[model samples]
Target chain A: MNDVITLAHGAGGRQTAELIDRVFKAHFSNPQFTGDDAAVLSIGGADLAFTTDGFIVSPPDFPGGDIGKLSICGTVNDLSCMGARPLYLSCAFVIEEGFPLAKVEKYAASMARTAAEAGVRIVAGDTKVAGKGQVDHLFITTTGIGQCLAGVHTSGTLARPGDVVIVSGDVGRHGCTILLARNQFGIDADVTSDCAPLWGTVEAMLGQTKDIHVIRDATRGGVGTVLYEIASQSHVGIHLDSQSVPVHPSVRGVCGMLGLEPLYLACEGRLVIVAPECEAPAILDVLHRQPYSQDAAVIGQVTAEQPGRVILRTEIGAETMLPPPGGELLPRIC
Target chain B: MNDVITLAHGAGGRQTAELIDRVFKAHFSNPQFTGDDAAVLSIGGADLAFTTDGFIVSPPDFPGGDIGKLSICGTVNDLSCMGARPLYLSCAFVIEEGFPLAKVEKYAASMARTAAEAGVRIVAGDTKVAGKGQVDHLFITTTGIGQCLAGVHTSGTLARPGDVVIVSGDVGRHGCTILLARNQFGIDADVTSDCAPLWGTVEAMLGQTKDIHVIRDATRGGVGTVLYEIASQSHVGIHLDSQSVPVHPSVRGVCGMLGLEPLYLACEGRLVIVAPECEAPAILDVLHRQPYSQDAAVIGQVTAEQPGRVILRTEIGAETMLPPPGGELLPRIC
Candidate 1:
C-alpha cells in the first residue's frame, strides 16, 4: 500500500476495498465485523442491523437533496439493504467555522423531514466546529440502528446462479446532478439527485417475499460497482441486458455528452436486488406500487458462468465485458 | 442565533446549548430526542443506549492517546454514562486526500485496542476522502449501541438535593495537555490526557450500587460545565468544597500559571458522579480500587439553597458562585 492515501482510496471500488482489507479489516477483524452494507448484531436475543456513512458531497445542496437528507438516506438505505426496518439514527456534524447558521438549520429541517418519511427517529447528535479552512462547509456522519425482520436475510454474498437482478429505479441521476452542480463542464441539462430513504421500498419487498438473495444500494460507485462487489462476494457472474436498464432521459443525455458510463454513476435512492427468478416478478410488482421504486426493472441476472465478471449484452445484441471499477472518477460525489 | 456560526457555538458551553436549542432541537424535537450523553432506546423489547460523537482533535496524536483512542472512548463513555454496557460501535471517517496511510493505520489500531478494552465491537464503518484542503487531516465520528442495564437509570436530571457529588479522578489533565500541545504560550508542563474507556469504572460502580443518580464525563467544557448542566437539569444547587477537589500537581501548576480554572478544563477519563450521600463511600470505594479512578473523592454535595447554581466553598469557608461557562475557551480540545 502507498504511504499516503489518495482520492481513489475512498472511491468505493477496488481501491477502497484494498484499503479496508489492509488497514481496517486487519485490525478490526471480529466475528461481527462486516463487509456488507450493515452489521447484523444479536442484541438481547434479537437481530439488529447497524451501519454508518459519512456524507461529504460538494455544493452541500443539489437539485433533489442536500447533505443532511443525503446523510439520513444513505444510512437508512444501508440498513434497509440488510432487510432491517430503520428505527433510530444518530447524526454527528463537523461544521466549518463561519458557515451560515440558517443553512445548518435548513439541513436539520431536511433531515427531520426525511427521517419522518422513513419512519426513523433522529435521537442523538453531536456538533463540532472546525476553523474556517480546516474543513469544508460541513460534513455529516449518520449512524443508524435497525431491527431485522423475522426470517429475512440479505447479503452481498447471497447472490446465486439463476437469480434475477432488479434495480429499484433509474440510475446515474445523483452522480450526474452532482457533476453538473460542480459546473466545471458547463453542460446545461436537467438532472435531479435520486436521493431518498429506501426502507419503505425494502419493507414492501420483504413483505412480499423473504427469499431475496442480495440487496444493495448503488451509492458511491453506482450499479456497476455494486454488481462487481456482489459478483466477487458470491463468486457468480452477472449478465446485464443493457437495453432493459432504466435511465432518466436527462441522466442519459448527460452521460452521453460526457462519454461517461451511466452504469458507474452513483445513485442514492436505487437498489440492486437479486432474488429467485420465479420471485422476481412478484418483487417487481411490490416495488412498482411504491413511490421510490416505481421505475423498478430487471436489468440483469446472476449466472454460474464467468464468475467475478459482469457481461453486458448491448442494445445491439453484442456482448462485452464491463470493465471493473478502479480509481476515483468523481471525488466527494456521495 | 447569529447568521453565521462562530467558534463559541461549538465550545460545548452556553453558545453550543443555544445552537442546539435554536436549530437542532427546534427541528428534531421528538419524544426520543436526547439532551443527555446518549439516548435510551427500546428496540426489539430490549433497552439500548445509542449515541454519536465526532472527534476532530487537532494534532491528532497526543501524550496519552490519539484521535482513534479518543473516538472509541468518547462514544463508549457516552453509553457508559447512560448505565449501558458498551456493545457495538460504528465509526465513520472523513479523511483528507493526502493523509498518510501509516497514520491512518496507527489511528485504526488505537481504535481497535480501545474498543477491545471497552468490550465493544467495531462492527461497521465508512470512510470518505475530501480534497486536500477541504478537510483537516481526518475526522472520526463513532456511534455506539449498548444494552442498558435492567434496573439502572442515570440522567443529568436525576440529581437530588441530598445527593453527593464525586470526582472520579484528578481533573483538567486532558484540556491542559491539549493547551500545552498547541504550544501557543511556550510553557511546558508534564501533563497527559485522561482519555480512557470508562465502562469498567461504571460497571464496577453499578456492581456496587444501582442507586447512582447521575454519571457524566467532563469532556469539552470539563467538570465545571458538567456540574452546571446537572444543577440546571435537576434544578438543584451544587456546593463544592474547593479544598477537597482533586487536581494533579502539573495540571494545577499549568492552570496557576495561565490563570485558568482547573474545574473548567476537560477530563476525558474522569466522571462527575452523583448519588445518595449514604452511597458515596461505597461508590468511592469501588472507584478508588479501579486503576482509572484511584483518585476518586467526594468533592461536593447537592443542595437546595440555590437551584441552578454551583457554589464553591473555600478553605476559609467563604462561598462564591462558580461562573457559568460561556463563549469559546479552547477550540478542538476534544
Candidate 2:
C-alpha cells in the first residue's frame, strides 16, 4: 500500500482489490464485506440513516485537527443530529502526490481517534492520488451510517412557535481561531480549536428528553444562517436576545475589533436546539454536564408571525436582521 | 451553498440546517434525506453495501470532467464493479470562497448526470466552504450505498488457478487524455475519455453469468497495479499475454514516444473481471453488446503455482514480472 498510486490502482482488477484489502478493509473489517455490491449488515430492525461529507480545508492539517478528523466528525455529527446512533463511517482520501507520509499518518491517527471517541468505526474507504499542485496535500470524504431512534422525527421544519432555542455552547470560537491562526495574529487566548465529537452531548439530551423538535450543529454560516433556515423550514420566525446568546469575551473582542459579527462566526462544538419550552431547562442541564458543552444557553424562541426571518435584539434594544453572510471570510481555518 | 462557508454552518443548529437545505439538500434530494440516519431503501432484498471516496484532484474542474463528477463516478463505480446495484449517493462539497458559481453549477450538473447514468439517486449531502487558496476551488466527497447480489462472493483473493481475466475495453485512453489536457502535449488521439459508468457492463455480464469471481475498475495505478492486487489478494499468480491486453494504437505510440507505460495509466470507465473458464466467453459476449464495452477482451488467466505474483508473456514470448510500480507515473488523470 505504501507503493505510490499509479493509474492502474483504480483499474477494476487485482491491484484495486489489494489496495482495498490492505488499506480500507484491513482497517475496517466487517462482516458486511461478505461479497456483495454493498456490504450488507443485519439491520436488526432499527431504522438506518446515511450521510456523506467532503473535507477540503486548506493545509489538510491544522492545529488541533486535520481534514481526516473533520471528515469523520462531520459525518458522525450529521448522523447523531438526526437522532441516529452512528455505527460506521466510510472514508475516501484524495491525496496530492508528494504529500509527506508523516502528515498522512497523523491525519489517519486523528481519524482513528475521533471515530473511536464518537463510537463509530471506519468500515470502508478508497484512496486516489492526484499529481502535485493538482490538489493540496489531502482531501477526505466521509459517509456515515447510523441506526435511528424508534419514534423520533426531528427536523428543521418541525419547530413550532412555542419551541425554545438552546445553544450547546459559546459561538465564534472556531471561526475566530481559524482567523487568528491564518493571520498569525498574536491573540493570547489559548484558543484551541473547538472541534470535538458532539455525540456525547447529543446522546445526553436525547437520553434526558425526547421532546426535541430540531437539533442542528452550528458550523458554517454560524447561528444567523441556522436560525434563518429553521424559520424558513418550519415557517416560523426567530427572535434572539443578543445578550442571551453566549460568546467568549476573546471572541467578542476579536469580532468587535474586526467589525466581524460574532453571530455569523463559525462554531464547531456547538448546536442549536428547538424544543418545547417546558424541556429547554432540562436539555440545558443535561448539556452542561458534558465537558464540551458547559456553556449551553437558551438563546431564543420560534414564532409564527415573522416566518422566514431571524432577528437579534441588541443590548441597546435595537433589532437587526441576521442573514447569512456573503462568502467565507476566512479560509481553511477548519 | 455557493457562498463561502462559515463556522456556524457546521454548528448543530439552525445555521447547519440552512447549509444543508440551501446548499446540499437542494443539489442532492432523495429518500435518504427523509429524516433517517442511514437511508432505508429496498433494492429487492439485495445485500446492502456502501462505499466512500474523497475528491482532491487539482483543478477541481478538469478538461473532460471535474472533481464533482469524479466524486460521484468514483464511488458509484466502486460499488458497481463489485456487482452492487447502486441505490443512493451522498455528496459533500468542501468549497473555497471566491470560486465561481458557474463552475460549481457545471460540476453539479455533471455530478447529477453521472448519478443518473449510473441509475442511482443523489440522496444526502453536506457543504463546507473554506478560505481561498486554503483549498482548491472545490473538493467533492461521495459515498455510495447499494445492494449487492446475494451469493456474489467476489473477492480479489478469490481468483483461483485457471480463472480468466477480461478487460471491459481499451486501457490508457483516460490517462493519456489527461496528459494532453494538462501538458498541452500535441499527441492528438480521437479518444474521448473512457470515463463512464461501468455498471451497465457489470449488469450485462451479471445477467449472463453468476460465476464472475472478481471485478474492479482500472483507475489509478492502471491495469498492472490492479492485477498485482488481485494476485496478492487471492494468493494466486496472474499470467498475461501482452498482445491480448487491449491498448489503443495511439496510446501505444504515445507510450513508446513518451516513455510512459500504458499499463500504469489511469482508467475511469473500464473494468477488469476474473471469471471461471466456463463463463469467460459468455461474459465477453454480454460485454461486447454494450457500445461502451466493444473492446472487451480476455487478456490473461489466474494461477495457483506462483501465488502473489504477476507474470506477463511479452510480444517476443518472454516472461517478465510486472510488480506494482514504485511511484505515480501519471497523476490526476483519474
* Superposed Cα deviation of residue B276, candidate 2 (Å): 1.3
Candidate 1 C-alpha lDDT tens digits along B226-312: 999999999999999999999999999999999999999988899999999999989989999998999999999999989999999
lDDT score, residue B68, model 2? 66
Off by over 4 Å in 1: none
Q: What is the DockQ of candidate 2?
A: 0.15
lDDT tens per residue, model 2, B147-167: 777656676667889999999
Q: How many backbone clashes does candidate 2 have?
A: 68
Q: Report the TM-score of candidate 1, chain A only.
A: 0.99
- Model 1 lDDT vs. the true structure? 0.94
TM-score of chain A by itself in each prediction: 0.99, 0.83
- Give the 10-residue window scoring lowest on summed lDDT in candidate 2 chain B: B34-43
Top model number, TM-score: 1
* Candidate 1 docking DockQ: 0.87
* Top lDDT hit: 1
- In angstroms, the error of model 1 at A252 is 1.9
In the order shown, the candidates' DockQ scores are 0.87, 0.15
